[model samples]
Target: MEAPHSIISIISSLLHIYILVLVIRVVLDLVAVFARSWRPTGPVLLLANLVYSLTDPPLRFLRRRIPALTLGSFGIDLSFLALWFGIVIVQYLLAILSGLL
Candidate 1:
């Protein structure tokens, strides 16, 4: 059987990769919003579309179930941040549990 530390290492690595993907998706969306005038064409558009397609399903579901917070005129996407933090917390918990095991 594989060692427990090795299993935890693998899980941690996967979680890190998942977080990186989420961060990339967030960054792309921010860029798309800020650079609206710059047309996303060819490979750039394809990459942006791919990221959105992959990330949007869970985000959309969370957004609907979670309430949006209003800060004066602007509303903040609490769900997005919550999801990001939730993932981090879960990763930390897994790491701690793995250490104990």
Candidate 2:
């Protein structure tokens, strides 16, 4: 029981951290949209690439199924929001399974 609980706890924590990384990715992307001329270099570029690698696969899957919403000149990508909610739901389920809820 302890072993399973510990594993669930670890997974829940990792999912939470991934959500935070996704948020950072979103912020960076928004900044990039506004400041098109400001290109990331060195560490910033590396970080951006890292975030993309971690996030892209799942997002691409969602993007294929659900296109972004466009309003006039602005567009909103719903993949991130969807992923965030999915992660949270999974975390909640894990918590319940572990009897932490």
The candidate maximizing TM-score is 2
TM-scores for all candidates: the values are 0.81, 0.89
User: Per-residue lDDT for 1-101 in model 2, tens only?
Assistant: 58887888799889988988898898888899899998899999999999999999999999898889999998988887889889989988997888852
List candidate 1 stretches off by more than 4 Å. 1-3
Give every collision pair in model 2: none
**Could you give candidate 1's per-residue lDDT for residues 1-101 as a string of tens digits?**
35988888888898788778788888887876899877678997897787777778878989999989998999988888877888889899988988688
Winner by lDDT: 2
